[model samples]
Target: MASPLIGITTMNALRHDGLAAVSLLRRYVIALTEAGATPVLIPSAMPDDGVDALLTRLDGVLFSGGGDIAPEYFGGAPHPRIGGVDPERDALELALLRRVVEDGVPFLGICRGCQLVNVGFGGTLYTHIADQHPGALKHDYYPDSPRDLLVHEVRLKEGSRLAEIVGVEVFRVNSLHHQGIERLGDGLEAVAYAPDGLVEAVEVPGHPFGMAVQWHPEWLTAHATARALFRAFVEAARGSD
Candidate 1:
């Protein structure tokens, strides 16, 4: 049997040499590789026809963390803190996510990808959690803090797909975003949450393997739960072959 070919979305970024490029963090690749899957980085600027062709060959799609999505897509309020709004990336991901969901393709979303899943399915966001979510916890613990630092605990629903994959009901996760789902997208169910009552994870009710988490599980692969999450995703993708 062949290993699953998982497609990961990349951001439009400038290379160290000041040239334009599509980029994704190495942690995502490392995590997926360890899960027995072949990872492919999908450019944010790929044309519609190219993305359509690529999707046919992919067994699964992983939406990695990145900068904020544009407020216009989700009817979100504007905020000064909303930076790195890539129109092309936003357009690409929104279309890709819906297409994958409709096609019943296995997918796992992280951080910004989580927010995108919500927005793509007729949902809303806090825009800025600290300012919008009353008494929100400090979820933006990145750049200045260690990437793998376990910041807070997230409780999972007992019978949820996410909980079953992680094999736990409660665990600590690293917080690294200032936005959260205010209203879950249609057909999506919240499977995990933070102590502050913020949605931390969600799964599509009937899809083969459609799930997303607010935390960066890739950075926490040292933990058994994180590894299990990726392992389950890869296994699901492998079934698609």
Candidate 2:
């Protein structure tokens, strides 16, 4: 039998469980399932005392994209643009990230997932773009536009795994994140970066396999290289060590 896959969910804050719920993305579930792993949803609301209970049953963990992480997490005050911050989800996923890292479990983090992993590991976010990175292409979601396929060219570090995965030095990726990695975490190295110098991807050195990306590859599931990412992650979750 194939090994099962895990996708982290936002804590169930409100009663509704629709698209608005603070949980795993439906697209991520589709991608994981299509990538040959059974999707198991882990709630971010899991109690601090029960963090282990959720960790033991999974082969891998995926932190899905969502709203802003409370700046209080990284010891800063909230900015006016800092809307939709979730404290419960922040508390839960931070513990989960630390636990998974200690356990040497394979993990993947998406946009907000990327930011959360950064902050969870003692890194900081740009928070507001104007306040940090001045004058850059706006990276906001455009739900109603006809040309929704927004693209930006990101340059990969020569020897980075990103280069290996995509088999290209420069690639076009859609950007929807406002906050970006300001400083990389202690054990983390950025594998890809945007033209504007925002860290687009990060990985931990000497780990089973854990990586985070600021772009939503899951949304582009049919793309060749995007599929490679899911395959690499599923394969990593089954590490021989």
Candidate 2 accuracy as lDDT:
0.77
Model 1, 173-195: lDDT tens per residue?
A: 99999889999888889999999
In model 2, state the lDDT of residue 164: 82
Name the TM-score of candidate 2. Answer: 0.90
Predicted structure with the largest lDDT when compared to the true one: 1
Clashes by residue pair, model 2: 10-23
RMSD of each: 0.8, 2.6
Tell me model 1's lDDT, rounded to 2 decimals: 0.93
Model 2, poorest ten-residue lDDT window? 141-150
Error of 1 at 28 (Å): 0.3
C-alpha lDDT of residue 100 in model 1? 89
Rate residue 20 of model 1 by lDDT: 96
